[model samples]
Target: MLTALRLLACRRAPRLPDIAPVGHVVGCLSPTLLTSLASGHAWAGRLPSSCRVRVPLGDLQCVVYSVYAPLQPSTLSSTSTGPADFDGRAFLNFGTSAQLGFLTSEPPQQPSVRDHAGIDCFPFFSPDRYVLLAASLNGGNVLAEFRPNSGRLARAANRTAVSVRDCLAAVATKPASASDPDPLISPTLLDERCGGGTQGGSVLGLRMSSCRSLGRLYRSVCLGLINNLLSLCPPAALRQAGIDRIILAGSALRRNAVLRRAAALRFDECQFQSIVLEDGGARQQPAVADGAAGLAAQFLDWVAAGRGES
Candidate 1:
């Protein structure tokens, strides 16, 4: 990657002339694909069936790709140096898997790759801007499956289902339900966990306290993941970049009151406004995919007008 970047930098003596505009611009976002034959620094490569890149871009390609970050959905009118609200901004694609990043006017200085558990952090962007990004393998998909009815119910309920399992291990020993149960549990201990236990008749009551407890656990796991990612994004960097808002997107947040509450509290604590993407009369996954497609369309428009990289 470094070699390719160096080659690109050294090869160019004078700036390239403004490439003629093609018929249209090609735009895309994570988890969705759009395709076109025309190619240029301002336009993205062929779109994929999914929003993600099944084939990772080479370093040179990444450098070129960074040019598109500023053209993301919410930043259309944003100046090249910074948005009006701040010097930079962040977009958190909150989904079954989550990605958080900041848009910058320059390519990042360091190689952006790191691993926290199974999640991957890296840089993605077009030439005029960089996206400092971190992605998690865990997302709302696990939370959805964690429900008692899901096929992966056992796995989802397991302490190991989340990255913060160790943190909850000591606390999980408390019965899923008990009169003297932990505060996290509700008054009624009867729920699915009561099956085959000494409380034979408790399950008959159908008290949802146990289910609520499970939901709390899932929410905690989600919060931990988000918090961990935020911690990795240095405060100094955010302040320097003037990040004032956080835009959250994905299906994981739909019908997820707990996760949304946690995020609101955390962002408030950090003095940042949090904007939850609307459901748009659909589930979170479809809404996210549709949003990506819409953004891609706008991006293509932005590029075709010669508003992209110089």
Candidate 2:
């Protein structure tokens, strides 16, 4: 009887605002779309209602969408409800595939890949002006190595773990990055084959070669990953933009202590703060559904505020 009542209540719950007109739809933007936009192609498909833009990009017009629309406003930390220049925030979706982004009033016109020490970082903008970091590595695999497991995934994890540890030990003697005060523990080692600098491979190569046991690699790769992401946003840029709030989302982030620590270590300073999103007993919903729902609500609010203007 209790379950039945709960089900009924769920059904009766109010729906989010309507974004698209009847028969129109919105869905996840594919990687092809991202590639096209990066290549300066015009938008070709159905238009999303809220948090999307079709603006001029040089000679071509492009469309961009927000990836973190599923996160609720309440999940935001110390951000002003009113629009302001420095009130922007950064949201990191830590998952099997992790993503990092910044939320602001205007999406970047042209996105570029940045280099931090030896790591390559790609930044993209969502419909809501959230700039996301698109990674080439499997975040889940990294985590698998961070935690102890007893199966196939564990083996792959071990391989990456050793590489990462060796890379860290090598950089330990080098000069630290300008942004961080700690030694050079980073994910560049995991991507060694993809062009990590010689420093990452040569420094600890000899020492790590003798130590083959996975037991020696204890620190989680999450730290390196988060540190690299934060490096994308330098302190001056963050302070100038007023983006102090950090939102850490993803099932992985909620369950993993190492990931949480990584986030706290990098963001818990005077200039930056972080707030975690709690599911709070809500029924599990797909990220797409949550994002679409939020878009609908924003659309309704926009329409209402316009005095019923279309």
Candidate 3:
């Protein structure tokens, strides 16, 4: 990726006249920044100074949550000349790793929090990691089966040809009744990375009717995931940073209406407005790529106006 970026910086193509040099190219490594840019919060000259953005991107191993906030003037070093100095953006990344011990039965220690350009950043851990395990236990692939078919399930609610994800969402979203009791699925999963010896995840309250119900199982998984996420970056902290809107961008939240709806319902209690990138009325396939392109365009404009010339 770096090599490709370097080549694009050094070699200017006739078709693309606004390509910035390598020195001027700003790399966006955080999902928070990407989601902020994709959601139209960041611009060439109008970067927000007092907004917070929360982004959760699901990776193969775990789900990563990135919270972006403007840099506090007090945190800036006199000699530092980094991108954060220019754009006033700083982010905290929390990865759902088993080592964090968030899923342990015992009360876990407080995650080490760092001050990053004013925003409080926490150590990495994967709270949503169990969702993947639950999917695997149910004999379904989370990435392949759940993510890909999420769009179909979200768009066409009445479609007959439902995917595994659709079925899970349907069952998960239904109101609980006497016939359907909620299952309890532990988010903890044992991994080599964990500090102490721990067992894998467990399922409880398995009734004859609910044992085979994937939705109930997944509902517990989703609740666990979202709750873990909120524990890391609570709405009170976001509001303290003057963030009223949260832009949800990621394969998991963007494609899965189930996850999106769950997240919306959960965050609604905090009174924070949420925006799903996929449901923005306009189609934004590959949102990160579009955001990167938009940033490049902004950089070109910034350079043309005697800024970002270094």
Candidate 4:
């Protein structure tokens, strides 16, 4: 894993490692495990009620809700020996990379606490992305349409022209109407690889007045995205898992205030405290990468302490 990290950092072709004096080697670990460590919240037998909610937006968007909890006896029905049969290698399969299970370094003699529950292909569905897609569908530049004089004014003001950032700001300030449209926009349009027969997207409730209304469009799209996420990992399931705290991470939640507000409101009823990871009033570095680096440091420390000799 360290070698892979080095290659990625250098952005160079992989080459054979030269023979050198190395004290220890670290194996590849799950990103979820690294993220848990990044939070600096220990969960292996301590603070088992906390949950890590990772919403990472890359080529594909995914939301992972992980907790450290013991495996219930009923969860091991397949083996017939109940929790005793758990082998630490077991994962609660949720189709193509979406899984919920105990993540441990070694199989415990009995059912014990473990880390993750991942849901892949879950769209982040940010307002800017949605507007861009909507513009493409209509064959017009939404930003240009919204700000007809932005180009000329920007030149006078010595600044750049209208952008998606402006659109997101508009959405954030404008209050969502009580009678706002539902499912007016489909988030599946953002990613073509989303499975389960949800390839096509919808744009229902569009009207002459709202056809260009960024706020209304944003609200509708945000609701669709949040609803889809909840269906995959419902609040009820989190409650059942004894999850008390939810750590929200992702560029989508951090940049867009409206999206963050909407997510908090949706999960408000669950009574789980939502924490958005930040550093000195700015977005923090990626948790997984930070965690990986932390592990590498710890490994070096272990070697220095003579623990690696074993």
Candidate 5:
């Protein structure tokens, strides 16, 4: 197994073209895959036992785990001076032996609140302003709710499902239950009477940095799907695909706690594995496994191509 990367850095560089950071960008695993990875010995970790939840970075709708690292300092001396001054660090990548490193300092204590647990300041969105959000990591069942109205998360109704799971096919359980209150944020909320004119809608949802309205469409289905995602998908199924790994911006996930628990559940038949490409990029076995790289590359390519249409 390869050690996870520690990409600690500070400051921004014009030479390093700004990349857009889309929320819930990809489903790095499937529920089944998650289960498989959890069975591996290398899946163990020193994750904070208790995580206080917090609102996600976007939409103010997401629920995530909040970790508090004791003695963790905010500022530290930089070890390298390439373009920015940063004290980078590495941690864990659920169920895998690889380290999850980012371009930031690894303090002795976790932050009381973390907008993003898996990743932060995505190069794509940090300076470039490309925001994306996904709801599931199941390769077959995934959706990318395009940010139609600025940075807010696209409600279940408006979100576009990608290669979603077969179970997600039951998308018509409820028909917009409009009278029930779309409690979650939606396009209609942007209306004047909705109290969202100047407040910036969901302060966190604005992470996308695009105010392009996708217009009203068949969004009721989204509500139904959300129900299914929360209810239908079994725990074992989530285990298979590396459940909860796929994060939706503003999604109310339990953070690293769920990930840690997932590993403790079972992990004998599984093993952590990774392969390095000639380009230096690595592919994990249990989590993203076989074709994740190819799938991701193609997905990004399509996104790049779609820009021409808009």
Candidate 6:
């Protein structure tokens, strides 16, 4: 229920002033639409209970609403209900008007990453729900679909690689980045962007910019991989939190295959049931086929856990 919901209290008169705030009247809206808008704000949590912010207008508090027609993931850190510009009060108090504007308008736009003020997770689902998808050395993409209606999905293997790269670079050079305090680009990610000027630092303008560029490159890679997955995967259960069993059904990894690469990364952490693709399907040596089968079983385990069927 809207706790602060109330009709406009006209100071001059109830005769309906020409410039009355929006909350003077907000009729019913389908909860489905509301849920979509509101639920879109949590990083795996609930939406704000009150859609409208109350703005004071010289003894006449204006019931301001918001209409961020395209509420970017970078924008919603403050409020619209109070004065503008560094009021020392939190942003939302002054942003009641933004809220009012958002609520009264006809379906605002989806929030972008920056709109959430460097916190892209909000106004979106749990970060875990977004799989870290990536293209295989082959043409196929490795991915886990997300179900908005279900549990969290595993982080994309690609994300893991990028993260690992970032971590290693941090340890090696401790460069700044989007996620760092003295945030600068890591030496490695920047080197790739600079076209191999990594050692002399000539290709890169500076360490900071290069680090930022690497973050952007990582995002670009992640997004591109996601697009590929959406195009390649089957329609049903494509958006769920994990891979369908069928993806593994025919995915026995060949030597130096895509599946093997993903599995090789995780081999130290997980055990595999060996099936050597090179040794006439014998377990003479660990092969890509072994990794694929093992990966398949692990993916199945994840799906089962997601469904509480394990």
TM-scores of all predicted structures:
0.46, 0.47, 0.46, 0.47, 0.16, 0.17
Regarding TM-score, does 1 or 4 come out ahead? 4
lDDT, candidates in the order shown? 0.46, 0.46, 0.40, 0.40, 0.25, 0.25
Point out the worst 10-residue segment of candidate 5 by lDDT. Answer: 60-69
- Model 2 is weakest, by summed lDDT over 10 consecutive residues, at 55-64
lDDT of 1 by residue, 193-308 (tens): 21233331112233455354544454445556566456445444555556777766555554555566656666778887876543465433324334344445645565677764
Each model's RMSD to truth, in Å?
A: 14.4, 16.8, 14.5, 15.6, 23.6, 23.9
Better of 2 and 3 by lDDT: 2
lDDT for model 6, please. 0.25
lDDT of 4 by residue, 120-231 (tens): 2122122111100000121112222433443344345656566656756777887766665433565544332224454555777777667546566666655555544554
Q: Any idea what lDDT model 3 has?
A: 0.40
User: Which is superior by lDDT, 2 or 6?
Assistant: 2
TM-score sort, best first: 4, 2, 1, 3, 6, 5
The better candidate by TM-score, 1 or 6, is 1
lDDT of 2 at 175: 34
Residue ranges of candidate 6 with Cα displaced over 4 Å: 1-168, 171-212, 234-310
Model 1 residue 179 lDDT score = 62
After best superposition, candidate 6 residue 188: deviation in angstroms? 22
C-alpha RMSD (angstroms) for model 6: 23.9
Off by over 4 Å in 1: 1-87, 110-125, 149-212, 234-236, 277-310
Backbone clashes (count) for model 3 = 5
- Deviation of model 4 at 277, angstroms: 1.9
- Name the better of 2 and 4 by TM-score: 4
Please give, for residues 1-310, the per-residue lDDT of candidate 2 as tens digits: 9999999999898779545432123454466665565464454343443334322111000111223344434322122244424246666666665555554544444233223332233322122333334342435556666554423334475564444434434433333234423333455444533344453311122234223432223232555667555555454455554557767666666665556666776787645787665457653322434554444565456566762224
lDDT tens digits by residue: candidate 6, 67-155: 11111211211222222221111111111011000111111223321132211111111111111111122122211111110111112
